[model samples]
Target chain A: MKSLAELQAIKDKMKDKVVLREGTGEIRVVVGMATCGIAAGARPVLNAFVEGVNKENLSDKVTVSQTGCIGICQYEPVVEVFEAGKEKVTYVKMNAEKAAQVIESHLKNGNVIEKYTIGANQ
Target chain B: MKELSLNILDIAGNSVKAGATKVGITITETDETLSLVFRDNGCGMTKEQVENVTDPFFTTRTTRNVGLGIPFLKLAAEQTGGSFSIESATKEENPGNHGTTTTAFFYKNNIDFTPLGDVISTVTTLIMGSPGIDWVFTHTYGEKETRIDTSEIRAVLGDDVPLDSYEVIEWIKSSLEEEYDSFYK
Candidate 1:
């Protein structure tokens, strides 16, 4: 069994890192997780983002979160990325593979995959 | 949804929407039965709302005309020759005790029953989305049980650390993985 003592070790190591990132400008990745989003397979997309972010060591620079319906059920499984001063870029009809690509192109490279954005889909 | 875990995610999303601070999810499995219970200390709903929850047309949101989460869950459970129910006490009526409880039973032996797939991911996703909420998840099968409570982890980590931090999430994942490993052993 994994003990709480191990959790303490993790806390001790992460305490300084988390404290350092407070209020720092970072990119925000938000996934739509309402009924529409889940039905359209948002879980894997969300998972892919989380795993990808952690794999790339971007946890400190990019925060992944979830939100309810965005009033665009047709664009279910939507993802939106927000940088400090830029307009929010919403990506529609996303999947796990596409999520990885977004991580590589948009999050890691600082280039919005305009083709995947809701603007192009609409 | 293809997986019961997805249904769990969908249903619990309502609890998050209702401003729940504490969410409890319990899964109990017997030879022929798979039972699920989701309880939340949220804003709850009106009696009328509870009565109409299984109706696909009933929704509290103005942004959409249809709500399918409860209806789909009801259909999934009933199709397997099992049962589903929801009970709630609104804030106006129950005040400090307001919340919602949803119970569903499924005959696992039934051919049409959906599998509970990748529940660990569902739990982690919930925590990642709502780091402040207290989540208690327990899964019992045969003579073994696996459980995790965010409140306990929070007590150890202190309030300064977010539960969704990558390292914390990784720890949660590995811990659940270890417990689940022992379930089948």
Candidate 2:
């Protein structure tokens, strides 16, 4: 079992990392979390984004947040990525694995993972 | 839900959606039963609303018109030979007050009862996720017990220190884990 001591360590390590990224980021990562989204297992996908962004040290460039339904309940857990001045990319039926790949390929490398996008399914 | 903490989050999210300023959550474990209760000073439901909540098709959220948190909780408890219930004090009916209370009992000794998940995660996430809302959480394991009230944290935090601040979130997690340790460890 994990302990309080571990949480303390995380704070000490993340202080400068999270605070510095407060407003300078232009890339937005949004996870849908309405009842439909949550029941479809969006929690892990959301956690993956929060942890993955911090792990990749992209907090300085990306902002992670949650939102209610995007009106497409059947395709949840949906993740949308919005870059400044660019069209939003909606990724449907997401899981932890795909979230990780998005962070690595799209967030860090600047190349969108096409198959994960809504267009791929359409 | 995979974990009790997630269930807590889901239910509390409903509290938040209902416009609750203060939410109370209690968890107890004994030789006979393991139970959880969530009470919130939010918008209380009508009798019709409460009765229909068990019908998987009912939902208040306009997002997609589906609700499952309460129904699943009722099912989870009943499946284990335990019981589940919901009570509400509607302001319209009561005149002076309003809120919703949900309770679930799971016989600890039952073969189908699920294990209590990481509760530290439960309380911390509740606080971290909703900085504006106040939370009171009580946990009991056997004869030992622990209570955490965010108002106390708020008094120390003052106005400038946000509950969602990096350090505060860390401290809340540490303190909650320590408290849980006192009961179970």
Candidate 3:
């Protein structure tokens, strides 16, 4: 079993680093996680974003989280991106691969992969 | 669902949606049976709601016309020659003691039994998705066991530090993997 003491050590070491980035992210990536979303394979999409953001070293600027049903059962596995002073962008019928693309294009380069957006699906 | 862990994630999400401050999940495996129990300290359902929960068409959410989380889980267990049940006490009925407990038993020997895949990801996802909720998880395979309590972790890290921090989430994933590793060794 892993000890709580080791967890304590991690906290002590990362405490300062965590404080610097706390609640100050400029972009938010929210994945739909309701029943509809889960059945449509949103878990991997969510994981892809989290891992993608971490791997790209964008953790300080981007925060990936989850939301409940967005009322679009036909378009399950939805993802919404919220950035300061911009219209919220909704992506529909997403997968892990698309998530990585979204991170690379929209989150990284400020190019909102409009092809994957809900507007294109509609 | 393709995997049982996904069902666990879906069902536990219900607990979170119910405003549960603390959720307890236990997976006990034996030679023939795999049992799952999810208990929460949240607003429970009424008798009528509990009765309708397993119906695919019934849902608490106004956003969608159907709810499949509970129904699918029930089907998953029953398909394996197992059983599923839910008990709840609404806040109006039980006052401060309101909550829900869902249990399912699966006969692992049955051909229809689904594999429990990537539970570490399911758990870490839940923790990251809802850091304010204290999640207590325990999985026992015969004599070996793996356990984690977010409340304990929170006590160590204190309120200023969030459980969903990248480093914290990574630590949790590795810790769980280490525990599972010891089980095999």
Candidate 4:
């Protein structure tokens, strides 16, 4: 069994140094994680975001976080992408596979994955 | 919620938003039983509000109409061959006191008790990471018991940053996974 002290040490090491004081070209990926979002499959979506960012070695540039009810439960599991200076792009009804594409096209190549964006789905 | 811990997180979030000063969470896992109890010193709900709490369309807050969290927790408990109950006192023996306590119980099913630890950690992390909320989490497995206080973390954190920010989330995930690996199997 792992001790609490061991866990605390690990936590201290993983603490993020980058602060989002002024955005500074950082990419923010927020996943809805409220009850409806999770029931609709947000966990895998979150895992995908973490995995995709790591796989692309973009962990430093992109930060993934979970948010409570976005007041749009029907569209969950939703993923919102915010580039440093651009308008926020919301992706509705997302899954792990869609998250990967978002990374490949949007995060990497700077082109929005049009088909998965909220505008295309609507 | 995908996992039991997330359910606790949602409920604790509601308590903190309701202006709770202190929250208590207790998890018990033994050979025959698995139980989770959460109590808060927040604004207690009325009888009508309690009745409507399980209704998906009845919400006192303006954020959204669908209230699926408590109902989901009740269902999760029921599905695991267990039960759930909620108690509230708008004005108890004291002249003007109000509080609410919710407890959900589940029976063991030949699975290890390590998952209970994860559930406790999740609740602790969610409450600790949020601002202006204090939480005490107690976990019991047979004769062993562990208690975690968020104030300790707050002492270390000071006013520098929030507890549940991006970095803390990763740490919480990894720590819980490490403590409850067998349960996930």
lDDT of 4 by residue, A57-94 (tens): 78767877777788888799999998877999999999
Report each candidate's C-alpha RMSD, comma-separated, in the order given.
1.5, 3.7, 1.5, 4.9
Tell me how many clashing residue pairs each candidate has. 0, 0, 0, 0
Kindly report the docking quality category of candidate 1.
medium
- Looking at candidate 3, what is the lDDT of residue B88? 100
lDDT of 4 at B137: 77
The reply for model 2, stretches above 4 Å from the true place, is: A1-21, A55-57
| DockQ in order | 0.75, 0.24, 0.71, 0.28
Collision pairs in model 2? none
Q: For candidate 3, lDDT tens digit of each residue in A54-104?
A: 999898899999998898868989999999999999999999999999999
Local accuracy by lDDT, each model? 0.91, 0.78, 0.92, 0.70
Q: In terms of DockQ, which candidate is strongest?
A: 1
Per-residue C-alpha lDDT of model 1 across residues A10-120, encoded as one tens digit per residue: 988878777776544489999999888998999999999999988997877888889888989999899999998899999999999999999999999999999999889
In candidate 4 chain B, where is summed lDDT lowest over 10 consecutive residues?
B110-119
**DockQ value of candidate 4:** 0.28
Recovered native contacts, candidate 4: 0.22
Model 1 lDDT, full chain set: 0.91
Runs in model 1 deviating more than 4 A are none
Alpha-carbon TM-score of each model against the true structure: 0.95, 0.84, 0.96, 0.72
Tens-digit lDDT track of model 4 for B1-185: 55677677667666765567788888887777878888888787788888878777887767867788888788778777788888776654333556678898887683422233236445534653354677777667776665656666555555554555444445555644555554423
Those runs of model 4 whose alpha carbons end farther than 4 Å from true positions after fitting are A1-28, A47-65, A83-85, B1-3, B79-81, B89-99, B110-132, B144-148, B160-162, B165-178, B181-185
